[model samples]
Target: MPRPASDKRERLTEAAITLARAHGLEATTLAAIATEAGVAQGSVYYYFKTKADVAQAVADGVAESLASARSTLGPEPTDALVGFLGAYVDDAAAICAHGSLLATASAGTGSDRAHREAIDWLAERFGDLGFAAEAARARAVHLLAGIEGGAALAHALNDLSPLEREATHLGRWVANASA
Candidate 1:
């Protein structure tokens, strides 16, 4: 039986994400993803026309996962912010641990969508805390930059406690800023 289009696309996306995490995005070629997914090389082309497309899909998947995780933090604003920041720290550390592959992809061209999505998500979350739009945007950027920097440092040191600590600090900062 032929595989459903959605299933094939999902398999390809999963394979791409896995390979990107393991080998870095630059090394995760269509052929490699195809092998990983047990599909033909052309199968990947059917869903994603280029490496950037696949990378974007993987990044989008990550964004969606992060959003879902944040949504599970219940209805409390403070709890949600803390939970989201914690998850962000963990996720950033994981991505950084993927080394140059993920780094390259994250820093590579066409990552504007990922960055914008993240900023928008953070802004919305901050807005939930009754922050003015401008304040929320600035705080969101500050928090994300801090988390990204801290995560990079922690990943380089092979210790995530610092990232966690930094995230906690930022969370408190946000709480105060919202007051």
Candidate 2:
């Protein structure tokens, strides 16, 4: 019996994300994803027309997970912001250490739209925290850059302490900004 389309697509997506996270986006081939997913190589094309599509799906998945995690913090604006930033930093750092997949995704073709949408989502989250529009935009950008920077630095140095410290500081900053 054939697997459900949604299940197959999800498996393919998970495989792609795992591959990208282990070997970087450039190494995330449809064949490899299919193999990891335990499906025929051609099956990947049925769900994702191109490698870019797979990458975009992965990015969207990460964004969705982050959004869900953020939602669990309740409706308190400051708490939500702090929790979101902390979760984002931890998630990004983990992904980066996996193979810097997020960085590779950001550099890939057709990634601009996904990146912009992710930023917009974050900005809206900040805006919901009662920040002025410009301030929310700035905070979103700052938080993202700080997380990315911290992750890269930690990776380069083979250290997790710096990333943890930076994430904590950023969380405090978000809380203060929201206050």
Candidate 3:
């Protein structure tokens, strides 16, 4: 029996993730994704209009996973921020081995939306703690920048220590909000 269309799309998205991790998004091609997915090149086009579409699919998957992971974050602002950073770093550690995939995913619309949501959530947490709206948003942006930069550094070094240190540092900054 023939597989379902969603199955093929899932296979294609998985293949895209694999290829993007192994070769970075710029180096990953539709043909390569098709080959990796055990589907014809035409099948790739059937599911996605362009490479960016496939990258978007990958980004969507990442966002979904991170959202699920974040459901358990502690209520406190500092703890929540630390937990959020930990979740992002954990997710990044998986794909950042090759490094380019995380960077590429970060550029996608789905990832961008997820990032914005995270910033909003964190900002709200800060607001709950009495921070001004502008200050809360600024802090959220700064923490997110550190998370992204730390992931990139972790990818380059093939070690997660840099990201860990960043989480710790950012945790301190969030904690200082109480002072």
lDDT of 2 by residue, 27-136 (tens): 78889999999999788988899877887877766555555665676766667667765665566545445325655665554454444554676678789877778888
lDDT top scorer = 3
Q: Which lDDT tens digits does candidate 1 get at residues 1-179?
A: 99554688888888988887766677788999999999988889989998778877777665565556766877776777677677766676455543344346566545554456667877877888888889888877887778777776777787887778888898888667643
Error of 3 at 131 (Å): 1.5
Would you list the C-alpha lDDT of every candidate in the order shown? 0.73, 0.70, 0.75
Distance (Å) between predicted and true CA of 166, model 2? Answer: 1.1
lDDT (0-100) at residue 123 of candidate 1? 82
In candidate 3 the C-alpha lDDT for residue 110 amounts to: 41
Given candidate 3, what's the lDDT at residue 46? 90
Candidate 3 wrong stretches, greater than 4 Å: 1-5, 89-92, 95-111
Residue 149 C-alpha lDDT in model 3 = 78
State the TM-score for model 1.
0.80
- Model 3: which residue pairs collide? none
- Candidate 1: how many backbone clashes? 1
Error of 2 at 130 (Å): 3.8
Model 2 CA lDDT for position 129: 76
Ranking by lDDT: 3, 1, 2
Model 1, C-alpha of 16: deviation from truth (Å)? 0.7
lDDT of 3 at 90: 68
